[model samples]
Target: MTSFGIWGLIPPVLTITLAFITKDVMVSLFLGIFSGALIVAGGNPLVAIINLTDMVAGSLNDGWNIRIFLFCALLGGLVGMLSKTGSAHAFGRWAADKLHTQKTSLLMTWFCGLLIFIDDYFNSLAVGTVMRPITDKNKVSRAQLAYILDSTAAPVCILVPISSWVITVMSIVKGSEGFDALGVSEFSFFIRSVPYNLYALLTIIMVLVIILSGRNFGPMAKSIAYAQETGNLYNEKYGPAPGEIDIDGDVNADKAKPLDMLFPIIVLIVSAVILFPVTTYLSSIDGETITSVGAAAASMSLGDAFNNTDASMALFYAVIFTLVITYIYYTVRKLFTIKEASGAITDGIKSMVPALIILTMAWTIGTVIKNSPADGGLGLAAYLSDAVVGGGFPIALVPVIAFALSALISFSTGTSWGTFAIMIPIVMPIAVGLAQAKGLADAGLLNAAMISVSAVLGGSVFGDHASPISDTTILSSTGAGCPHLEHVATQMPYAITTAVCALVGFFVGGIFLNVLAAWIVTLACFAAAMVFLPKILNN
Candidate 1:
């Protein structure tokens, strides 16, 4: 209701408008940031300039933000090197030989998506890049590719125990007095409750079912028909012709050994998994039991052991490692000259310039929201939680309301982390208090589990799956090479369907039924979507 809250809506509106108007997302994003800075400075031109520099500096200094930026940069470099070495094409050819049918291709796409569950950003980019060519060869549309990536992004993250997300949610739950009142450790409660996260579990099943059934609906169905008629799943400009080799014919002719493409990705995945635990251990090397953020902080500080510890410094190291490894592997194999490898890296970075701009602008807008007057921003989330409790709603409905509010904030702000940060402290205590009030003393364990895990997961992913400003959404669009708005428009119906079903499942299945029955009902809904919807829509 405050002017600051109204101001918050301006950045996305301007960014989206400029992106469509100029067909340049980056330009639009920067302008949006500038406008936000102006508003934050209260129209003081001099203060606006100063705040802009400070915002950028603060973002760069933020430990989590720095690591994420570096991760994206390293991923970009790895993708470039793979493309330069023709490894992607090599893998595509190999996959083509092994899988003969559309169903196989689709299933493979889903499996790969499932396996790369470490991070949503990583999953969206890696899966889309690796699978796009194969899907196109099998006549699948870019919209379909976007759908798979979008569905997997949030759903996969929710299920993973050791992900950055799990850590964030755990911290929030543990800090809340409400959770302590429920008489269980937040982490223990969350682990036990994972089985009951019906929405996330069902969404994963729904994705696999969609892949197996080969039935598309909404914009996705139209896209599939278009691809069938035209034989171009993505835009004609982006992909190779049906029978022709890629632009680099000689490179395509040379069959890359499987290790060339698979080895690095496997290394990246295994390294992350192994290093996470090791990093956690090392973080406590300072005599402090390392929490998740603490571990990230420790990892940032262990520059020499890991080869770079400073956030800014580690980024440079990662870049150098990627370039050197790429050069050595491709140059020795004679996949490309030194010049071609260099050019490919340059092109890859150039391709991501727009994304970087968008990220920076998004970061700035986040800054404005963080620093804005309490009355002017979404501080209303806290007030709203109080209002809900005052309205005599059952304690069980706390999680449901939190989930819905989180979804709304995520949708409007276009970031899950921000929404999570704002809601967790406010909602968790209310849940615990309500559970006690309901005289569910024995059921405290179950109630805590539901409130902490179910609510957080639901809230975190609601916007991520559907929000146009969401990083996952953008990455999915970029990966599929689908127009951003097109992907949003096509996928909205599916996201809404799942969300609606999830609401009913959470209320009736999660609250009323036993835990096992809740899961069954959730899975049943997924199955119905897979089997019934396509037939109904196609007819």
Candidate 2:
């Protein structure tokens, strides 16, 4: 789409390459963004620098972006306060006794990741923070914890219909061409596609299999072996982990109760669940005089409210409310004085500084790739989408092609939502047109559409799961106290294994036009891999 043609690939490629080679994400992202800006500026270095600054500023200027930034910082504060009060350690000690083994501890971590499925952002940060102390006590590597958090975050969010991811996905589905022709609502179509989302289902199953089988492989195996033998939870060569923050308050280990930690996390989760609908309702009446939640709720169904909700705003409100309640509760418990608590909160915010910087850079670089050439971007998404749409694959390969294409775009761009926005529009028409050309009836056409859509969703998640520049991936590392690149390095093999299985399933399913056949083959591939790949790779 851009005059730059293949040049659009330079930014993300450079960023990812430098990240792997130098292991400095910040510098890599900056150079990547700078390169893209230079291309957009027609090789004017001065203009590129100015454009770069403005682009990052533009990303932060969005209300949603700012809200997410604040939410992450505030969540860090809450985690810090819990740690300062010794509540996190107390809960860890209690959980360690009950869990009794490394396997159970990791399983509990996986379970917690699944339970907090409302939002991937919240799921990663909250679950990792709450589960870290326990995982650490059990000697599970931070890379492993981060992988679970990263794996569960987007994969679980995309699979669950009642999640932050669903609203975006449903909206995309609704606007997609030929979707209305099917006479099926977006929500129903989404539900139907869930069973076809082999990557997510298989990735989730892979997590359980890895834990239950205790068969680690690839870079992950080395990390696990290192942790088990050296008693070091992370690779020390990567320097101090990203999420390690020092609290200014004295530890209250002996006096702290596990409830001190559990109650706040409960409140955080419950409040988020309740506030999502409430915030959606309120946002719909932003310009009106409606001041009451009751009035807003009376006008629409709970499902409607959730579908229309502003997830970032809802989470922002949830974390703020939790912090308030937690402060009061900690005060009542005499965990710390107001001044000490304030210092802990301040230190917690400081801990998030690195994460904030990485996210900002990631957003800016994404902007660089997404913006049109005239607007000082490489238009990478457009370029990639155009290429895939023009590829002219066989009709039966649409589902698998969509899955692989979506993964490439998402990995290159570092944003799954952006991938959905681009791919769904492009994939829908292709799949529908291909089915009609094959003289398929309504049922066959619908099957093609659903499979393609599910493939896009799953593939998008795969890229987001694996990309180092992805926000969820960075947040997972921050949350789990792992080095960012270490998480990516360790998780890629597992993500790739699941993706390969999903690809095989989509390929066979595309041929048969059968969801059951797809699922069976996917499971079969995963099972076969589980029996063989781990042993081979670990050896």
Candidate 3:
């Protein structure tokens, strides 16, 4: 392996640091990308500039990035249109009217987050924006909202069999040499292993427990109390006014009807679900199957569909369906003047500008890492695994390490998909090899699978949840109307608590349960967190 020294690592580290300090995610990421390009180009000034431009252009042209941006822009437009039409406010007001209790409001938010499990990015943005007003009306803090959104996105996606993320992971795994040796079909293995993902199961349980008990701790507790006292959970800038429904002052207060909000949300969900089957069927034609990520990417690249007459054509059709349905609703309901609707879409795209810039930089960083001498990220993991596995540190710690390493890479590059792509192949083979060496080939395969998958999910989510350059985190803050760092600060303690408990669970299970150990540890951690968290808050 080649060494790029500390110089190779400096750009990503500086990006994250600056994001934390300046709270300007786009600026931080752009600087990170520029620095990486500078490193790659070295002393050639012209080459450095060209490298930067090419890095960004390549990223933008990537099918994955293009799809992500398209979805984001369209979703942003949908969200903005919903808000402007009074649909979001109307739905929020109606839901608030019906769910009189705080617990109900929280539960609804939790359920909504879970329901939007088709895609994490969509879940984070759409769920947070739609539910923010309702949560705020009921006095839930932005920290809590961010926590719910972040917690649910990756966890729920990992658990869901047909989600875009699972498809991507399975594709990566199937393509690996390890899977061929093991004779395990990617889809079947993914389905069989879902139950063993302790982090996903435990995190969901933990989120529900926090919601039901109203148990806030650390920064979350402070945030909740502050919201209750001031009636402004979204921000300190909004002032300490009580929940006042000023008919004239409320944006979109008068025009919104219950169905106006309900219809589009319902349509969005239905469209996504319906498109899944359509995309799958289309992908199966000519033996060219579209995985979840591929479907999304193909759907965004409609222009290609017109020429090639390929499976990606289904995606183009779905895009058309989305536009037509959205347009019909807007026009039939007289939601906005044609001009207003146009402006709303423009504003929606404007809101995504910052996200688009961050994404471009994130892609550039990922490319630089891939092309660098430290191409494979396995050195650190291999060293740690070798040092710890024989030292009797406990098997549970394996997943914990996986999670931590995954988190580190994801945070550095600000892309969970890239982290997953890099880590799965490197880690799984080592895990299987280690288990086989212990004369536990059968048990080794299962254990390795659990640990590798858990690590990937946990690490991917950790970075996505906390990193300011993370698109999901940024979108959550934007949706909740919270200052980005404020959301990060307020939610960090809760994430930490869950992480610590998860580590403990991994250990207990590893030493005792073997394959079932993940579940055993996860349940134990969930129970302990539920019991102890409230008391800690009281203290």
Candidate 4:
């Protein structure tokens, strides 16, 4: 109910503007955070400076956020070791023999993204680390690679049932009063809603279409053309990208083997998959003590454990375990000496410095914008939520409305999780109420509810794909070793196209309360996009 009026809009708007203009994410994020701090400090410059530092520190204080920070840095170290040991190069060589063409190489990257659906952060960084070398070898532009990474990362996570994103959505839904009143369990609702998640589904479809058809438009087309013609993965004008490191000049390059890289990554993936439920089960045990891992496994259902899993913590532990084993593995193989391995890891951590700084600033600015007014933050989500609810649209349009509003909030704030937290509770009840008021049957009402929830899920992903400040977007660029803004610029067109298709789907579904009708119209829209968009935009 409390807000800073229009003041909430300034920070994100300014940050986004400055990022595009200056192509400096750190400075843009800092000024955005400082401006918000200044507002929070009531226009006092000195207090604003102090508030900025405190806010940045405060954002880092959360256990989950800090774990994610460590996971990224540790993952970078793992990547560095992989490169230094010539693992990435050797694997790329192995892949190049089979992949042969750009299309096959990119398709493999897209498939890899789909396979790693546990967490978006893990998906982006892990897929990028392994696939970047292959993509580069095949003349795929870093922008195209980033786009594939971004599109698949969040979209696939949201679509899969056993992912961190789904668990979070389930938790939110379980806590909502509407789901309780409807006598629906969160798991059931989420599963039912998945089919209606037009945006995420359409976005994934769009990625395949682009990859298969080799159609490029907008900045992505330009970047691809430039890469194919000049043999440079990125624009020279953009210079070095965040998380970019040279893996070609390592001393041990001649001795690297394909398994050297593949083995460590396989360890990371298997470790994360195992740890997610194990940690959650361990955390669930209370009062009585569970003695062994086998005993813990016997105690709870895998579904329940995953429902309550801490994805960040799971990834944090996975990366740590991988780093330890990898260091020993590389050294034992005589690829690098102990000191050499240490130095490579240090450089790898250093490579992630830009991503880390940008991530920290992104969190700080999100805090400034989403924190309540009483907490010295702008309450942007509250303001926008209030505006949408107060607009007084017809009930049948709830799906379309929810989609648009969720996109706006997520894009402006650059945090889809924050958007979900704000929108779900508000939108769910209204949807149920509207369905009831229309004298709809139980099946029809459930259909409406599913469509509405799916819209929110889809629209939030649109922002995650397109927003410059989005953590997934940032990580995608970092992992792909592409300039952040160039990734943003190239990805926006594809994101917008998918969004347009989703909007049509939501509109049709809302009017008819039919999921099948929604899918048909959505596909039709996409078909039109595929046939005509390149012709229109490529010019």
Please give, for residues 456-503, the per-residue lDDT of candidate 1 as tens digits. 567568787888888899888877777777788778878877776676
Q: 1 or 3: which has the higher TM-score? A: 3
TM-score-wise, the better of 1 and 2 is 2
TM-score of the candidate numbered 2? 0.66
> For every model in order, what is the number of clashing pairs?
2, 0, 1, 0
Global lDDT of each candidate:
0.61, 0.79, 0.61, 0.77
Clashes by residue pair, model 2: none
Q: How does model 3 fare in lDDT?
A: 0.61
lDDT of 4 by residue, 1-539 (tens): 48797887788677657755664556766887898899888999999999888988986897766876777677767766766776655665676678868899899888878876755765687678778888887788999999999999999989865554665566555544356556555655776788899999888888998899988888899999999899989986866787654453456566888788668867887887898788877666664677666677788888766655776677688889988988888888889988888887887788777666766665676667656878878877556545544665566689999899889767866666655654665567667767766677578878878898888888888887788888899999999999988898899988998898899999999999999999999999989988888899888
Give the number of the best model, judged by lDDT. 2
Per-residue CA lDDT of model 2 for 1-539, tens digit only, reads 45477997788677657755664567777898899898888899999999999998987897766776787688768766766787755655677678857889899889878876655765687678767888887789999999999999999989865454665576556645556666565655776789899999888889998999887789999999999999999997866798553222466666777787678778888898898788878776755666577778888899877666766777789989999999999999888889989988887778767656766675676567656777677767566555655675576798999899888767866667656755675577667766766678778888988998899998999988888888899999998999988899999999999999999999998998889999999989988888898779977
Model 2 misses residue 161 by how many Å? 11
In model 2, which runs have C-alpha deviations exceeding 4 angstroms?
1-7, 96-204, 207-250, 286-292, 393-499, 506-518, 530-539
- Which ranking of candidates, highest lDDT first? 2, 4, 3, 1
TM-score of candidate 3 on Cα atoms, chains taken together: 0.65
Better of 2 and 4 by lDDT: 2
- TM-scores for all candidates: the values are 0.62, 0.66, 0.65, 0.66
C-alpha RMSD of each candidate structure in angstroms:
8.1, 6.9, 7.9, 6.9
